[model samples]
Target: MPRDTAYLQIADALRERIRAGEWTAGARLPSRARFAEEYAVGQSVAQRAMELLIIEGFLEGRAGSGTYVRGPRRRMRIPRSRLRRLSGPGGRDNGGGTWQSRSKARTPAPERIAARLAIAPGDPCVVTSYAFLSQGRPVETCESWEPMAVTDRTPVVLPENGPLKGAGVIERMRAIGVTVVSATEIPRPARADQARADLLGISVGDLITEIERTHYAADGRPVETADIMVADRRAEVAYEITFGP
Candidate 1:
């Protein structure tokens, strides 16, 4: 059998040690040069091994402090089934607390958002930015868009301004005589940008989960699209599917 590469071997050894509690959470590991000498590999290989562990959520890098075993992640389960339910005033009770949101109306839809809403690139839309918090700590952020063509002059033009403020997409559309039939979410792993990092209180380059979500009316009209961002170490998304009998 072909032997494992140097980095993989080193990474595996480190992983085992971590799992065995040789290095407890918050304990710093030796420098790359030291690890290379201990593992009989080049420093670059050791660095690669450390990077792998960081990406895998087993370790973290602190600028000028060195690498350390990551503490247990604080996770909140996001139920896909509950997303369609109408939320109370502030926002949905995410088992954390009432979510808070700030909104901007009459904003011109960005090109990508317009495409997602099946409208022209520069079409007017209402944008609502949400910061979901748990116990006063920011946990997730979402920016949602709705084309003006669908909600112009309607009571629901501004999502948060409507009488149904804080309601979910399906419920809000229903109030406007639009029956939302389906929703789709596509999630991708990403690195936190400067703005997001500041909002999330994490360092830039921290790992994040980005989800692109779209909701559609029964008539196949696009109703809304949103970009949701969550810190990797702060939440875990759970999808609950129920099959029809």
Candidate 2:
């Protein structure tokens, strides 16, 4: 078998055994020599398998000590239900977590962001940055952009200010008679850059999930768009769908 294939197979098998409770948390794993002997593979392949697991957050490597099973981290589920997230990121209400947002008004939208909002490039918009906290620790972060054309001069203009402060897209739009009706979220794997790592308190290059989201009004008008990031070790995203007649 190819080196890549061999290492992947070994990693998968080892992951299953670990999940099966063969080694409890903080337990030292067998040496690469032992694993190589058990799998009839080279020690290099065994080491690669161990490294994969370590990068996946399944095991921790100590400088002088051997790799050990990592303790379980909090795993919050992100519901994709339109109802749960209709308003905005962190709208699911899980874990009793709260978020704080800072909005800068009259910011010009960039080309791609303008495209997402269906507006002309450099159009004035309100840019809001959000940090969602759990136990006062940052678990997720988001950057939301709303075209000023849709909300300018309205009570809900600035996302975190005025009468409808922090009410989110759905309610804020509704308060201004915009009638938001649908939202779309596309989630993809990403690497935590320096800025992202600092926000989530993780090391750079860690795996993360980035969701591209947008809210639309009843007339198919794009009202709000955002980029939301969460560390994979911090939470998992789940899509909740309801079938109707």
Candidate 3:
């Protein structure tokens, strides 16, 4: 009881300080010893509070360095639509638009994903995962990974229906310097898990579509990989092709 409520209250208080500019971006916060003393809370309580702030995107910590205020949080809004398409190294048609970030727990690169980027498995990669909601209810989730060797700090703000978010993977890769020539997608059918069912508001074992895709650069090097899962009942998957030369 003491630890739970105290930690939340401390986090809430610190959240306000960041919003009020009491701590500016990139400013290092006091050490845990100082925070415990200043907040009149136990060290454990203070530590938990800091953890919460980090998750809430108010602060960041470097291993050898101390915790510091995050630079301004970027604000973005993805569009909502029924149409689906893939873009990037792999022709991953993300089920829908999503928020992308590079935080510790959710880095863009996973081992398999890094392989698609033509880097050693687990090398750093750009990552963004999207949650698709309809009428305020969750319906699907999608995640995409790109190697940092290619992205290299380029701003990746994908807007719903926007070029990067809407166009198929090949085009997006070209914009980033890689020219994606072809893609392979593997589609599979599976039952929803508890988390997927809850998000899509469907029963467990409900039919869902899972797609894993990899895109190859002009040199035949894989440039990106994506995983897309969609709720079958709530959404339909379709594709149309236009002739071009």
Q: Write the per-residue lDDT of candidate 2 for residues 1-245, one digit (tens) a residue.
A: 68779999999999998999999899999999999999999999999898788767787665457888985455777666767776565564656688888889999999999999999999999999998887777778889999999999998898888997877789999888899888888889887777888888876666788999998999999999999888777677787778986
Question: lDDT: which candidate is best?
Answer: 2
Score residue 6 of candidate 1 by CA lDDT: 80
The whole-model lDDT of each prediction reads 0.77, 0.84, 0.63
Give per-residue CA lDDT, model 3, range 44-107, as digits (tens): 8898898767645677755568888984343222222222244322123433443332222225
Please give me the total number of clashing residue pairs in predicted model 2. Answer: 0
Which regions of candidate 1 are displaced past 4 Å? Answer: 1-12, 15-27, 31-58, 63-65, 82-93
**Residue 197 in model 3: lDDT:** 76
Writing each residue's lDDT as its tens digit, candidate 1 over 1-245 gives 12248888888899999999999999999899998889777888899898888867899877658899994455676554534322422125458555767777788988899889998888888888888877677778888888888888888777777697766777777888999888778889888878989887777777788888888899898888888887776676666566776
Backbone clash count for every predicted candidate, in the order shown:
0, 0, 12
- Model 1 TM-score? 0.81
What stretches of model 3 exceed 4 Å from their correct place?
Answer: 1-84, 87-108, 155-168, 241-245
Ten contiguous residues with the weakest lDDT in model 1: 82-91
Model 2 TM-score on a 0 to 1 scale: 0.79
Better of 1 and 3 by lDDT: 1
